[model samples]
Target: MKRKTLREEIFYKGIGLHKGEDIKLRLIPAENGGIVFKRVDLEEGKNEILMDIENSFDLTRGTNLRNEFGASVYTIEHFLSALYIMNITDLIVELDGNELPILDGSAKIFVELLESVGTKNLKEDVEEIVIESPINLTVGDKHIVGLPFDGYKITYTIKFDHSFLKSQMLEVVVDLESYKNEIAKARTFGFDYEIEYLKNNNLALGGTLENAIVVKKDGVLNPDGLRYEDEFVRHKILDLIGDLKVLNRPIRGHIIAIKAGHALDIEFAKLLKK
Candidate 1:
């Protein structure tokens, strides 16, 4: 398949996940341009920030991208994951804030939007990176290893020291159908006890039962309950897909992650650039 871009522009506005600010985002077609973030709020040069790992910073709650001039866009993983699985290689995302809207804390809404607005194939072929050898990065008990594979796949394992989500693991062959049906709806989760701490630190101000799965000490507080029996692991895989976008191309490999997060995921991406 050739590279693809959005067929038409789409607009969205909602609450930012981190700073709780209202944000607006627009998706526009780009013939052959890869993913680029335009800070409509900035009134200066270099508001256009490429989604590259070198520009990533502050891996606190989500993936953040910063330009040399210090302009930034935060919490981009969910949006990036949607674009990755959609097989979109060229597009322009214009946002009028420093962070993206939380939007239920899953990629489902974005996936649906992309499906409805649709995509148009560009003339260029997608740039891709295929793992030809094993690559491993580890820090303490957290690790993400990539091995040679013909196509993209991931086996993620999350070990939570809690009764509700003790240990959950899943393996997914990354594709549009699998991503949408399996990973996209798995909401980002957090412990109920941590809400006050997160808020006091000025983070996750927009987080709520509506946007995330709130896990109590031994159960969940979300009225809807779990989407998948092992939604936690599925969400980890979902995040891996998004973090991998820092490669700026499609990747074909077998990835195994153990208790990983944005920091470790970005570390792996950085190694791949070497």
Candidate 2:
């Protein structure tokens, strides 16, 4: 596969889930350089953050990246997941704020926007991270393992104490079609009981029933129910897909994860790099 980038520029505007601030982003095609983020709100020369493990910043709520110059961006996993599934390797994401818009709290909108603009292939061939040996990582009860595989695959299991969601699991070979049809629409979820605490702590300020799946003790708070019966686990797969992009190349391996989140994902990424 050849390196890919957007065929033309596209713009997006929405509210940040954590900061509750309006944010804008412009996706510009790049000739060769891998995906990079430019914080337009910061100093010109020091604003760029490359899409690599060296920049990963573990945040409580989302995937974040910071540069040596102190420029940073939060809540990038959704967008990055869409780009990775689309096989986009070269682009510049220009952002006007510190966090990406939590559009619908899933990768669906990002995937749609990217498809609308289509993609252009560059001259270079694609590079991939092919696992030659098993890589196992365990942090307490949570664990993630990478094993040799011919195609990108993920097997994820999520367990929650809530009655509405006890245990969920999903396994699939990741391709654009599979992602769009099976995982892209799975929205981020939060427990209804946690809303007050999150808001009091200045988190989830922009989250709403429309953008996220709010799970109550009895059922979901959203009028529209889950897109899939096992959406929670699918969204976890989506997040894992994005988090692994910290490797900055397509991966040809089977990633098995159990009860994992952003922090463990980044740690697994760091382990994969070594």
Candidate 3:
């Protein structure tokens, strides 16, 4: 497959989830360079973080990447996930803050933005990762496994003790259309009990019912209900797709994830990278 980049420059502005600060993002087309995040707020030479498993660091709440100079960006998975399914391989993402905007807490907005501008293929070919055998990584009951497959697929299962969200399972042979329709709209969710903990940790400061699904013991707090019946699990699948972009290549495999999060996803990605 040919490497892809955006057809033209695009810009988005919103509030950073962790810092509750206004942030601006600009997408610039590149011929063949891999996806990179540049912190325009920082000094020129030390502000870029290339998306790679090696640069990934385990952070609470979301995925993060740090450059050799210690410039870092947080909460990148949602944006990366949109780029992955869109087949966008090469581009520059410029950010004016340390974290990305948590727009509606899903990839929906990003997907729409990409759809509006579209992508163009470059002259270079993409080397896709084709799993030939089972690759497994487990952290206790959480596990993610990639099996040999001719096409990209994801089987994600999520479980919680809460009555409103006990368990949800979904499987899909992924494509751009399937992703945009079935997965992109699912919003990230969290329980009301998690609010204080997240704030104490300096995370989710910008999160509101508008951006995330806040669940109470009785039901959802959002004025509008879920987009899908199994939106929670679908959102998990969305996160896995974004996290997998750390591999920096298209993957042709069946990924089975059970009760996994950013930490396990990064570890699984490292295994896939090797």
Candidate 4:
């Protein structure tokens, strides 16, 4: 397939989940190459920031990228996930804040925005990182394994000690159709206990029942419940798909992850690059 990018720039704004400040983002097309993030708010004396795996920082909460100029962008996984699923190769994401909008805590909003503007194909062949061998990493009981595949495939399993969500598994062969309907709309979730803990630690300040599926001891607290019965696992898969996009090219591999989070996911990508 040919590489694609937005035909025209699109803008979105929302509150930053961590900074609790208004954030604005603009997506613009670029020539076939790799995705780049430019900080439009920087002063004339400051340098522009770019997003890449090597510059990744703060894996605790979300995938963050920082530059030597001290400019940083956070929570880019949802937008990156949508671009990866759509096979977008080159683009410029211009933002005026340190964090992207939480945007309903899912990639659905971004996907819809991109679709609304339409995409234009560049006259360049798509490139991909074809796995040559099985790469495995295990930290305690959490494990991630990558094997050669003809196309991208992800199988994720999440286990929680909580009674409401004991264990759940989901698999997806990444494609635009499946990604939009199955993965993009899956919102991030948290247990009620975790929410309280995050607040105690002064994190996740923008999270709410509207943006995340909040689960308590007995059941979900969100009035509308889950978008999918297996949303928890699907969201895990969504995160994995986004992290894998850091490869800067389409990836042809089969990924199997168990109880893995941001740290392990980034580690797995780093190992694959080695």
Candidate 3, residue 57: Cα displacement in angstroms equals 0.7
- How far in Å is the alpha carbon of 18 misplaced in model 3? 1.2
Which ranking of candidates, highest lDDT first?
3, 2, 1, 4
Tell me which of candidates 2 and 4 scores higher on lDDT. 2
**Clashes by residue pair, model 1:** none
Q: Candidate 2, residue 192: CA error in Å?
A: 1.3
Screening candidate 3 with a backbone cut-off below 3 angstroms (N, C-alpha, C), the clashing residue pairs are none
Model 3, which residues run further than 4 Å from truth? none
Highest TM-score, which number? 3
Candidate 1 ranges with C-alpha deviation above 4 Å: none
TM-score of 4: 0.94
lDDT of 1 by residue, 1-274 (tens): 6888989999999999888888988999998658889998887577989888889999967899999988999989988899888888888899998988889889999999999989888787765787889999999999999999888889999998887779888988998888988999998999988999999999898887889999998789998898988888888888889988877678989999999999999999987777
Q: Runs in model 2 with CA error above 4 Å? A: none
TM-score per candidate, chains pooled: 0.96, 0.97, 0.97, 0.94
Clashing pairs in 4: none
lDDT against true structure, model 3: 0.92
Evaluate residue 4 in candidate 3 and report its C-alpha lDDT on the 0 to 100 scale: 95
Error of 2 at 14 (Å): 1.0
At residue 38, what lDDT does model 4 achieve? 79
User: What is the number of residue pairs that collide in model 3?
Assistant: 0
What are the Cα lDDT values of the candidates? 0.88, 0.91, 0.92, 0.84
Superposed on all Cα atoms, the candidates' RMSDs to the truth, in angstroms, are 1.3, 1.1, 1.0, 1.7
Candidate 3: 10-residue stretch with minimal lDDT: 52-61
